[model samples]
Target: MASPALTPTTPATRDVVLVPPAIAMVWTGAGRPHEIVAVPGVVLGAGETLVAIELATVCGSDVHTVEGHRAAPAPLVLGHEYVGRVIEVADGVRAVDGAHVQVGDRVVWSIMASCRECDRCRRGLPQKCRAVLKYGHERIQTHWELTGGFATHAHLRAGTAIVRVGESLRAEVLAPAACGGATAWAALARADEVADVDGATVLILGAGLIGLSACAMATDRGATVVVADPDPARRALAVRFGAAQVADPRDVRALTAALAATGSPEYDIVLEASGSPRAVQAALEVVGVGGVVVLVGSVFPTEPLPVDPERLVRGLITIRGVHNYAPRDLDAAVRYLRDRGAARPFEELVSARYPLAQIDQALAAASAGRAVRVGVDPRDAHRRC
Candidate 1:
């Protein structure tokens, strides 16, 4: 679809700086692969900022979109995990935390942009607001065109909560904070409320980046984590991330049986981060009576498992479902990476790095379980870093 006429932007009470054109990777569909597209830069509109993305990571949901597991509009710029520097800031634009922002400040923002007046927003659930503009998740036919991080330059629209980042946070470690880290933080936030997360038996159902991030976060709380993954390599990484035990998902039945034999109750808290619907039932089986299970993954739809509400009632098991995250989760994600990034080898989870054009290969590596997460640098198409 051809975009309509471009609206002229007039900077508020200041001179507007025009940016130069840059390249971006636009998703065509599942048929072939994303194509390289040249994005023309324009004058900064009021409440919009142009950023140069330093690192954008391919999320599991991005892989799901390319593989047809998740439904997304075609021909959009499809990336969200990112860290970038502000090249231009529109007038009257302020961070969500009410701090003043300027150009050249390294920053990270929430994936979901919400209207502050919505009911959900008032209740502190911005991700589910009536009108939420999620960067990278939206179809690219709208204005500015480059809403995702796969591009060399992206436009930060109004309602985006911009937080200036510190040097203590590395791109690879902070990139996933937009989605994965915030997601894990949101899920664990609920788990921490009902149960004693510190020193509790926390079972994470996937050792992917989100799971590993949850592992690290749980470690900070003194939780004894036991992670489960079908991939042996992921399970190994879980150990390094402070998981006391790692089990294969295929052996969930056996693993649960072994736990039953111990006579101690099952896990006090279960986090489903595998993105597999089947893991939901497995999670039910593993969570102890009166324990809590937070569904953090399942961004893609799959076969439905039998849900027995009576069982939940009888077991007193609290099941919470976290879709995206509250805005506070984003703040916590950046803060955790800033404060405790060096304490753990969270950077080790960054397994593969590829240039923007090689995103297909990066996605392939992540899909094949060779890497937990992959990075894409938009400026250098040929270099892998």
Candidate 2:
């Protein structure tokens, strides 16, 4: 007889008691088992706040972390893109009162926390702040400091980085803006410096969340956008989201022919979000000699790409890597969503929503590309308990 499948069960505490602790799905190591552990209540310090997580989304970077493609320590908090409510605020937090952020005020936060005294912070590049504490990096050895949104609540050190979500947006859709959407917006902002979008030709490699968002943002900026992806469903969705053209990234000959037929040998700018070495090479081939290539996706193991150094020297192609979003980038993304009513059709991108108990199922679905985005709602499981 075949073995039975293991169904995800509601997390249970010791002694069969139903205590609502922070449940986190953690990876032990490379090729090791993953489990859900219920951690005791996290304590907050002065000028800190505990946010009750409303919704958290699984991202591609999360997959990289799980598969040990990156140097992630075991038993780490996993999520970065999320929306939550302020449950408690510590003493000495005067700028934001209970009125400004009550016990139930919904908000979204940035993944990176920076010290204002850093030179990068002074220059408005908090993403590169020298005293930054990334949620997943194990180097930061502060208790209750490295926790992320994957749990029931995340601890936030007080600063001006958090953005209060307006009533018009939903948590499921707004969760991804903290990372994916913000990254795309920052890449587009940099690409705009070299290519005037009023009537320029732009190409995006990858039709995933960041790629589609790039298409929408470039269209909003008046650029004609072309998208390349292997998935037909994503390509169709890109068209609906405002892509003028779609092609397959693997078929370089076809892509070249298509571009040639359009009377342009190269696009003014190429946005690479696929993180594939081939995609990066293709972006170099597709962009004009003087065009720019903005890399927004994460590349693991620091692999080298098959690029001709001679071509790079002669092409003068401006290649830039965008790490994370600045505070101003987040504000700009919020404004774009509000002004253009861009998120009205965001429901289509949300492929599934699972209770926190089904976190394993959610991660599986995301890994299989079964959805554009998968959300975890903690309230559902909390209610059952």
Candidate 3:
């Protein structure tokens, strides 16, 4: 679709800045290569802001959508995990910390925008607001064509929870916080409700970005974490991120042995970050009495899980599923990254980097699952970080 003519920027008194056309890799449909286009000038409305994307990480969901494993709106901008500089902010827009947003501030925002007045928001479930507008999920519409992170510029709409991050943190370290990190924080928050993380025995089912994050956060809280993954490299990486023990998920004996070594016969909290059906069932069976199973990675369709009512009654297991995180969880994700990012090799997670023109290669690298997270820099195609 051809974009409209570029709009002129108003004066500083009107709180507007001139923004150049943005280069965007637009996803037209499943199994098709993204079309690279130069997006024309963007004019921000009330409670809106425009950002120049510095770096973005290709998320698992983005890979799934492109591979036709999941359905997403066609011709949408397909990235929600990114870090960028604020190029423009309209009146009444504030960060999640309640600080006034300013130009040139490096920031990350929640993937979904929720109307705070909705019933879901009033009930403390703002992430699922009836009128939620998620970044990278909606179709390309006029005046909001730069809604996702696969572009040089992103137009953030009202009700999006923005958070200002420190300049000291690298963009690669912070981009994934928008989705992977924030969702991990929410999953851990759910487990905390039934079983406290401090000094508890926790088992993480996958060693992907989210699982590694949970492992680090749980370890930081004094919990003993055991991470299980089929990949030896990921299992080794888990130790660097604070896993007490790492095991192959397919080896039931190894998982059981790891749990026993933690001085707990069963996990006090089991976080299922692998979307495999087998992992979901294993989460139920391995959780201790009164323990909670927080499922975060089963976003794709799979066969119905067979649950035994007697198991729930006798084991007293609490099963909770977390989708996108709350506004507060996004804040927690940033804080976690800021405080502990340097100590752990957070930068190592984004192993491969590509320029905006190479988005096809980036997505392929992510889909191959060879790297923990694949990065995209939307600046000059030849620019190196």
lDDT of 2 by residue, 247-343 (tens): 8889987677656655655788889998888888888887888789898764565578777778767888788889888876776766676676353
Candidate 3, 207-238: lDDT as tens digits: 99999999999999999999999999999999
Q: lDDT tens digits, residues 4-93, model 1?
A: 111223243333333445677888888677787766654455677778899988888888888887778777888888989988887677
Give the best candidate by lDDT. Answer: 3
Best by TM-score: 3
User: Which 10-residue window of candidate 2 scores lowest in summed lDDT?
Assistant: 1-10
> 221 in model 2: Cα distance from truth in Å?
1.2
- TM-score comparison, 2 vs 3, better candidate: 3
Model 1 regions more than 4 Å off: 1-19, 257-264, 381-385
Ranking by TM-score: 3, 1, 2
Candidate 1 worst ten-residue window by lDDT: 1-10
Q: Of 1 and 2, which scores higher on TM-score?
A: 1
The pairs that clash in candidate 1 are none
